[model samples]
Target: MEVSTSKELQAFGETSIEKIIEELREECEIEKHLPGGGYLHMSDELPYLVIYRNEDEDIEKGMDRATVRLILSEASFLIIGNKDFEGYQRLMFCLSEAMSSKFKSFLIIEVFAGDPESRKFKIKGPAGKLSTTIKVLQEQLDDVDSGYRALQLGETEVQDTLQRQPEGKKPLLDLPQLKDSGCLLLGVEVPPVYRSKEGEDYPVFFRSFKDDFVVALHKTIFHFIRIQTSSGVKSYRALGQKHLQEKVKEIDRQLAEIETSYEFLWLVSPANIRHIKDTFFETNYEQVLNYHYRLLPFDPDVLKRRLYNLKLEDVDDPALSYIFREKREELDLQISMLSERGSDSFFYNSMMLFGKISNDLQREAETILKEVNEKEDQDFKSIMKAEDFKILANREFDYFREQDKNFSSKVHVREDVNILMVSRGELYLPSDYKLNANETHALIQHEIGTHVLTYYNGQQQPLKLLSIGLTDYDTLQEGLAVLSEYLVGGLTANRMRTLAGRVVAASARMHGADFQEIFRLLNKDYNFTPQRAFNITSRIMQGGGFTKDISYLKGLVQLKKHLEEGGELAPLLSGKFALEHMPIINELKERRVLTPVKLTPRYLKSEETRKKLGKIREGIPLSQLINA
Candidate 1:
C-alpha cells in the first residue's frame, strides 16, 4: 500500500517492526524496567537496530535452540543519524496508532496467555528467532531519521507563538470550542506491546495498545490546550484587546455548577470552619482556600448576599430542626462570648471566626434539609427505625466495657473519670468507668494537651485565650490525638475502618437514609454485625450530623504520613502539655526540666502499642524516647 497523507505516512512509519521494538525498549526504560533483556543499553543519540527473523520458515523439524540462536547472531546492527523535531512528533503520532492496534491484538490473546500450557507458540527455539527478527528489522529504519528532523523544525514555530503570551493569561485551547474536542480524543487506545511483564504472561500476547495510551494523551493534550489559551490571553492583552470575557464567564458558570452539584460550600459551614481553624488549621486552611477559589468566579456582592440572608430555619426539615436549633444556639453563645470579650486572644478569635462560620453552616444545613424533605423516595426515613437504637446501645455498651478496663487505670488517677457512650438518641456509660480507648485518647489530647496545657502555658504569658484554644485548634487537637495514637502505636485497621464507616453512614443519612436503614446497610454491604453497624451509624446520626467521624481516619492518615516523612512529634506534643495548671511543657522542655511525655494510657494497653508502657518516660520527647 502506498502511503499518501500525513496520517498514512505516520501509520506506515510506525508499522516497521524495528521502530516498534525501539519504542517498546524506550518505554520499558521510562517505567524503570530492564531494557532489551538487560543486554542492550540506550542513550539519547546512539542508534539501536532490531532485526526480525521469520519464525515459521527458519524452524526445521530437528533444529535445536542453539541453531536458532546462531541465525539471530548474524542480524544485529546500529543505525546512525537523528530524526528532527517535527518528524519525531509525526512518528510518535503514528506510533501511538500502531500501538493501539497491537493492544487490541494482545487483548484478544490475553485469555489464552493466562494459561501458559495452552499457548500455541513454542518457547525454547522461538525466543532466539524472535530476538533475531527484532534486530534485523532495526537496520531497515535508517531512512526515517530525516523525517524526524523535519518534524522538529515545525514544533519550533508552535513554541515561538506560545512564547509571546503573558503571565496569568488564559490559553486559546481553553476556549469551549477546543475544550469540547476532548470527547473526540477518547477514541485513542494504548498498545499492548508496550505492556510486557516479566513473570505473569508472555509479552507477545499481552502488550499494551493505542486505547491504553488515550488517557495519558488526553491529559497531555488538555495541558497543551491550557498553555495555548494562557498564551492567547497574554497576546490579546498586549494588543489592548479583550476577547475572553464571555469565555471566562462561561468557565465560571461551569465551575459554579460543579460546586453546587457537589455541595462544596456545605463543608465550610460554621461548625466545620471553626473545627478546622481550631483543630486542624493547616489542612482546613487548604480546604478553605479551595472553597474561596471556587467562589472567586462569582461576584463578591453575590457571595455576600448569599451569606447574609442564609438561615437554618428556612431550609431545615422538622425532623432536623431540633438538632439545627441546638447547634445554632451553641454557636450563637460562642459568638456572643467572643463579641463581648473583644480581645486578641486566640480562643476568643477562634470563637468569633466560628460564629461567622455558624451562620454559613446554618444556611447550608437548611438547604440540605429542604432538599431532603422535598425529595420523593425519602430512602432515609426507613433508616430511623427503632430497632437500630437497641443495636447501637448494645454495641456501645460492649465496646465501652472492653475499652474501659484496658485504658482507664493508667490515664485517670481518679476513679470518677467517665467513659460515656452516646448512641441512637441515648447515652450509656458504666457508672464506674465512663470512656473508651478512643474517647480517652481524645480527652488526654484535647482536654489535657490543649485545654490544660494552654491554661498552664497562659499563666506564664500575659494572654488567657492562648491557654484556652486557637480557632484552628481542631486541626492541632485532632492531629495531636492521632499523633498520640501513633506514638503509642494504637492505630489499628479496625479503628480506621470504623472511622471510614462513619463517613459512609453519614453520607447515606444525608441522602435521606435514617439510622436503622444505615445500620442495616452497613451490616449488609460492609459485613458489620447488626449491633456494631447500628452503633457506628447511630453515633453519627444522633449528633444531627456525623462530621467528627471523618476526623479519626483523616487525622491518623495525615499523622502517619507526617511521621513517616520525618516530622517530629515531640515539638507538637510539648507545645501543648501541662500538669494541672502548672508550667508550660514546651517551656519546661527548653529549660530541660520536663521529663519525657508518656504515651496515653489507652495506647499503652492497646494491641498496637509500639513500645512497652513501663519503658516510656514522662515528659521526654517522643523521638528521643523512641530512639532511646
Candidate 2:
C-alpha cells in the first residue's frame, strides 16, 4: 500500500484521525536517531498497519489467540514512548479516537503512582487537551462506570508495585492491566513536574478520565509512546513559548515580592537610631590606604571589569534600579562623610583598636611561631632569627592563612600592600583571643553557633537576597554572635574593654583623626602597642569610613540588654529572620511564627559615653552576662 504523503495529511483539517496517525508515524521516525529511540519502530508500524487493515481479526481469532498479537506487541513500544506530555497527549487522542469508532466498548485504567494532582505536565494545556480526548472517547464508548472501577484497581496495583521497588531505583511500570478487558496506563510523574505549583490542574483531568474505553485508550496510547517521551528529555526544552512567557512572569513576581519585603523592612527598622549614632566617628589618614585595600581586595581594574560585566547599573526595572543607585550613593556618601570629618572623631580610635587587636593577636601568634622556630622552623628562617617586627608580620601571614583557606597571595593579597586581608569569616586572637575550654565553647557559640548557624539557616531559605546578607543584618548578626559568647560564659572584662576600645576608636574616627594621631593616642593613652594602634587605626580609616568599628561594643550592649530582659534567641536564628528586614519578621510574628525582632543602635543618645562611664564607675566590668 502507498503511504500517505505529508500534503495529504495536512489537508485533513489538521485534526483528522488519518492525518494525526500519519504525522505520528513521521515524527516517530524522525525521533529515532536523536538519542533514545522514538515510538513506532518498523516492527510496531507493520503490526499497526496489519491491525488497521483487518480490524475484524479479533472477532475471527478471539481476544486470547489472534494474528494481531504481533501488532499489539509492537504497539506497546509506541505506548511506552508516550511517557512525555506532548507524546502522551497526541497518542491518547489518536487511540481514543480510534477505539471510540472501532470498538463497542473499551476500558482504560490510568494509574499515576503519586498524587495525580501533583503529576501535572509542565506543558500548559496538556491536562485539558488530554481530558478533551478522554471525554470524546468516553462519550463514544458510553461505559464511564466500568472505566472508573478499572482506574481504581489500576491505581492500587501501581502503588503496590512501586512500593516494592528498591529505594532510589525507578519502577519499571506503575501497574499492569489486561488490555480490551481493562487497559492500564501506569507511571510515576517526574519529580520536577510533580513538585511544580502548576500541578494543581492535574486532578481535574485525572477525574475526567475515570472510566471505560477512554481509560483503555489512555493506557494504549501511553504504552505505545512511553519510551519516546521520557520526562527528562522533555522538561527544560519542551516548554512552549506560552509556558516560557508564564515562567518569566513568575520570576518577575518573585523579584517583586523580594523588593516589597525589603522596602517594608526598611520602613520599620530603626534607621533614625543608626543616623543619630553615626555622628561621632573620625577618619584616620595613614591607615586609610590599608583600610581601603583591606575591605576591597580586588584591584580597581578587576573590579571595573566585573562591574561592567555585571551591568548591575543597567537594570531595567525602575524599583531595582533605584535600589542599586541608592546603595552606590550610600557607599559614596559614607566615603565622603568620613573624608570630610576632621581628626577629632573615632577614625584614630578605630585605628587604635585595629592596632591593639592586631598586635595582641600577633603576640600570641609570635609565641607559637617562636616554638616552631626553636623546633621544625629551621627550613625557613626561625622566628628567633627574625626581628620582632618580622616575627609579627610572619604571624599575621600565618594567622590570615589559617583563617581563610581560599586566601591566595596572588589574587586576594598583593605583595605591594605588605598586609594580608580576609573579606569573610570572623577574625579573632588566642590569648585575649584564644579560648580556654570554656572560652572555646563560647567562641563556638558566638562564631559557629550564632554567625555560621544563622548563615547556613538563611541559606536554607528560598530567597537569595536573604542568604546573601541584608543591609542591617550586620547589627543583629554581631549582636547575636556576642550574645552567644555571653550565653556560653565567654564574656569577660578584657572582652568588654576590647569592645569599648573599638567604640572609642570608631568615635575618634568620626571626629577625623589621622592614622598617626590615632596610633599615638592608642599607644600613649589606651596602652596599646604602636603596631596594634596602627592596625586598628588603619582598619577604621582605610575604607574611607569607620562603620565596622562601632558595631562591636554597640552590638554587645544591645545583646546584653536583650538577654537581661529575657528575650528569646531562637527567633533570631530562623531562616527567614533578618534584622534589616524587620517588617517581614513582624509579619511572621503576626502570623504566629517566631522571627528576629528589629535591631536598633545602642548609642542613640549619649549612650556610648554613658556605657563607658558606667563601666569605669562600677569597676565590675562593662560586659555583664544576664544570667550571671
Candidate 3:
C-alpha cells in the first residue's frame, strides 16, 4: 500500500502513524488476542482501551486484519466487534466518545478513506449531534448552526442520491467545515463545493474508530507546513519588537555621561603621608593617630538624579530587565560609597559588597613574600619615561589599527595625570611614571587587551550598555586583565602580594586601623617594602576606603574557576561585560539583534597566544605563580 501520494500526506511522515500507536499504548492496551472464542474480561481500570487484530484472516491470501476493543472503566463495558460493509462505523462512534472523555472536551469525529476522488467519509459527534445539512448551509449563512439545519433537507436528498449511485461515482463533500470545531473533526474535511476546490485548502484531521471484529482502517494523515509570506502592504506592524534595545541604550548613555570611574577616583590622597611619618616617629604609642584623610570634589546628587530617572520598567525582556536592574543597584551602591567616603560606614559597606580578605589568603601572601625575599633581588626598574610610554601606546594603537582599520583611541600624557585612566576614548598616563618590559606587557593586556577591546566591541553594538559597563563589570574585566597578565607571562610575585595586601588592608581599615597601623602591619609583618606597604595602605585609605581594588584578586579567583569549567573567552571580549550578562549577550546574538564582534584583542587574534593559553589550563593559584 502507498503511504502517501501528495505533499500534504508526505508531511505526516513515516512515523506519524507509529507515534499515534505509541500514544495509544500509553493511554490504553493494544495487542493481538485470541480471535475464535476468547472470554471478555472486565478490567478494574476505568476507560481501559485495547486494540487487536483477528487471527482468522486467510493465511493463503496473506491479508491482514485489525480490530479495536474499548472498555469504559467507569461506565458500562463496551464490546465492539468488527463489522463488514459498515466500514468502522461502530468503531468510530466508540473512539469519538472515548476521545471526548479523555480530552474533557466536546469532539466531532469525521472519517475519510480511499482515493481522493472516490473516498468514503463519515461524521459523528460525541455529545451534540450536528445537523447533517450543516455542510450545505455553511456557505450561504453566517450563523453556522442555523446554516447546518437550514440545509438539512438538501443533505437528505443528497444521501438518497449517494445511496443509489454506483461504486466510485458517489459525490465527495470535501468542503470547508465550521471555522473552529471547538468540537474535534475526526478525519473529514467539509468542502466549499462537494469536491476539492482549486487553490482552496483545508486542515487535515486524523482520528480512528474500529470494532474488535473488523479493522476500520482509514489512513487519513496530518501534515504541517510553515510558509513565510509578507502582506504586500508596507504598513504591517512587526511583532516581538519591544524597543528593549533602545531603552537599554538610553540608560547606558546616561551612565556614560556620569563616567563613574573617574568620578570615584580620588583627586587627592586621603592619608597625610608626611604627617603619618612624622607622627609615627614622634609618638610614643605603637599606633600612629594623627594622619588625616581627604575626600575628592564629587557630587553624588548628579548620579542619583540620572539613576533615579531611568525607566528600567520600560525594558520588556526579562533578561534585559535583570541586566538594567543590576546596573541600577550597582550604580546606587557606588554613589552611596562615594557619598560616605572617609567614614567608618564606608569601609563597612565596601566590605559588604567586596568581601574581606580571608586569613588564609593573608597567610599565603606572607609565605609567598618570604619566598620572594629569599630570591636574588631582581627588581624591575622603569627604563622608559612617560614620553616613551606614550610612544608605545600610540604604536600599540597603530598595531590594533592594522588589524582592524576602525580601531581608534587617543593616548594622552599629562603632568597632572593620576595613575593610568581610560575615559571616553583616551588612555591617560602620569608624565613621570615608567613601566618595565613585563609591567608594560601586563599593563598593555590589562588596559588595552581587555578594557580597550571591550570598549570598542561595545561601540559596534546598538546597545550602549556593553560600552557603559554592566553591573559588577569591574570584577570580570579586572579578572580577565589579571588573567591576561598570567597568559602573557607577566604576573609577578610583587604584584600578587600587593593585591593580597590590599585585601588585608581593607579588612584592617574596616576594623578602624589607621593608615600608619595598616602600613606598619604590611611592612613589618608581611615584609613588604615601605613603598609597597604605603601604596597598598594608601589605596585602601584613599576615597575613604575604595573597595574597587579588591576586584582584581576577587575577579582572578572567580575567573579561574570560570575558565576551569570550560567557559569561552571570546564572549567576554565582546564588550565591557560582567560574567552574569553572558546569557543576555548570547540571546541577543542568537536573535540577530546584536552584531558579531568587529574588534577582538590582538592577543586573542594571534595563533601564538592562543596556543600559549593551554599552559594555564586549569589555572595556577596566585601563590603558586607569585615567584614565577
Candidate 4:
C-alpha cells in the first residue's frame, strides 16, 4: 500500500517512478506483496538490491527455490521480484533512480538459474566496482563444494544488463537513456546445484545449498553496505528479519496451543500404579497387566490436522523458523504416541519420540549400575515424608516468585502422582512417598531448583516455546536436573542406580522383552528389589512401553560429554533447550531474540556444590559425582 508514510502505490509499474522516488527521501523499510506472485522487501532503506525475475521459464522448474529462500529470509539488502520483462525493467529503473537520488550510488544484483550441469557461478557485471562482490561470492562457492565448481567473472555494460530478458525476446530499457542513472547492476547466474537428473528439483539438496547461497549473499550485501551505502549496520547476521512478524508469533501461539492441548505423559500414564503393582506382585510378575489411562481430552486426528496446517514457511526469521519447524515435528510424534497408547504400535512411536537406547547409553547405564551397588538403598534410612518435601518445594518456588512477579510455579502434594515429579512448572508429590535426609534436599533441587527454575526462566522469554521446550529438551533438561541433585549434596549411590535401572529396562523393552521379561531383568539381573524393579518396569511399560525413563541416564551421559568438552551450565539455565541447539541458541542470544534467564538453581550457590560442579567440568565421571 504505502511505500513511504505519505506516498501510496496500489500497483508496481513504470508510471510510479517519480512518486516512489519521492518516498525514498527518508530512511524506511519497504514491503509489498504484489499481484502475480511477486514481492518487494527491504530490511531498511539500503543501497543494494537483489532482483529475481519471476517470468524466467527456468524458475517454474523449481531450480531457484534455494535462491528464493535466500531472498525471502529477509537479507539486509532491498529485494524486488517481478513476473514480466517490461514491468521488471520498469521497476528496476525506478529503484535505480530513487536509490541513486537518495544515496548518490547503488548496487543491484539479479539472480537467475544456469544450466543444471554448469557446476559454476557466472557473474556478469561492470568490471571495476563489482569485483569485490564477485570475489566474495566466488570464494563462498568453493566453500559449498569440495573443488568441482568455479566462479566465472565477466564484464557487461549497464544498459545491456538491464535490457536482457529470457528467450532473447527484446531489450526493455533504452540503452542511451539509462546509462547514466548511477546504479551498477550485476547479473549473477547461480547454477542449480539442487537440480536432479529428471530435471525435477531435489528438495533435499536445496537445504544443503540454501545456507551457502545465504552466506555468500549476505557477505556481498555487507560489503556493499560498508563500502557503498550509508547504512550503519555491521554484521550480516544483524541483517534480515530483525523484527518478528505477526505470522511468526501466531504460529508460535498456535504451536503452544497444540502443545498444551494434551498432557501426553500424564494421559498415557496408569491412574492406578499402586493398585496394579499389588496385583502384579500377587501374580509373581508373570501376567501382562492391562494398565488403565486417563480419557483423551482432544481428538488426536483433529489436533494433528491443525498441527500440519500451521505452515512454518510463513515464518520469516531463520532462527525462529528452524526452531519452530523442529518443535512441530516433535509434537507430531508426541501426539501420535497418545493414539498408539497400550498397543504394540506405541513402542515404535515411543522409540521415535524418546529415541532408542544406544550402546553408549547402555554401557554408561550398566557402568553406573556396577559402580553403585544396589545394596546402597538399604543402607540409607528414609527420613522425610511427602508433606515435608512439598513445604520445601513451595519455599523454593516462592523464592523465585519474589524476584519476578510473573514466576507462577506452584507445588502440590497429590494422591494421584506416583512419586516426585514436575509437570507444567508445578512440583507434584505422591502422598505415600518418603525421602531420606539427603534425598529431601536433592529432590528439592531436582524438582524445584532445576525443573521449576527453568520453567519460570523460560516464561520470562517472549518466545513461549522456550518455557514449553525445544525439541528433545527432556534429555538435556533431565540430565541437568539430575546434576542439580548432585550439586546440592543430595545425589546418592541408590539414586544413580535408579537412573541406571531405567536405561536397562528401556533397552530390554526395545529389544522385544515383554513386561514380565523386563521386570525380571531389573529384579534378577540388576538386583533391584521386586518392588523397585516392578515400579521401574511398570513406569517404562506405561502406554505400551514408554521409554522416556532412559532419558534420565542417557541425558547424564550426554551432559558429561558436553561438560568434558568444556561447556558451561549457566546459559543452559536460560530456558529448556537440547544440548545440540547451543549454536542456534547462541545466535538467537546474539540477535537479542531471547531474554536473559530470570532464575538459576540455588544449588550452584553452595561452596561444596560449586566444587563438585567444577570437578564435573574437569571431566570427572558422572558416577563419581555420588562420592563428590
The sequence of per-residue lDDT tens digits that candidate 4 reaches over residues 196-309 is: 645666665565466557667777777777876666656666555544566887898898889988877788888988788888878777765588888899988999999999
User: In what order do the candidates fall by TM-score, top score first?
Assistant: 4, 3, 2, 1
Name the candidate that leads on TM-score. 4
* Candidate order (lDDT): 4, 3, 2, 1
The CA lDDT at 23 in model 4 is 45
Candidate 4 or 3, higher lDDT: 4
Scored against the true structure, residue 12 in model 1 reaches a CA lDDT of: 20
lDDT of 3 by residue, 1-628 (tens): 1111111112222253344334443634222111222112211112222222222334323211111111111111222222221222233233434443443322222222223443223332211333333332222222222333433322211121212112342211111222221223322222222224242222111111111101111001001000111112111111112123345667667766655444555343444555554555466324444435445455678768877888764443445556767777777776777667667677666766566766665565555555555222345454566777777778778877886898889878866544676765468787767657677777787888778878888888877778868877878888888878866767777777777777777767767888778888888887877767766776777656766777887777767677777888878888887787776677666434577887666677666566555544556556775434
User: All models: lDDT?
Assistant: 0.31, 0.35, 0.51, 0.72
Clashes of each: 88, 78, 19, 1
Q: Kindly indicate the candidate among 2 and 4 with the higher TM-score.
A: 4
Total backbone collisions, model 1? 88
- Per-residue lDDT tens digits for candidate 1, residues 1-628, read 1111111122223344355446544542211111111121121111111111112223342222221221121111111112222333333233333333432210000000112121111111112323332222222112222233422211110111321112232221222322233211111111112223333323222112111222222232223223322222111101110111233233323322322332211222222222323332344212321111112233434443433333432321121222223333433333333222212242233333322223333333333222221112224433322233334344433443453332111121222212232211123333343334433444343334333333343323222223333223334445555455444444333433454565566556556675457767777776655545645754554323334444443444444445555554444443332111122323323322233433223333454444432233233222222233
Candidate 2 Cα deviation (angstroms), residue 23: 34
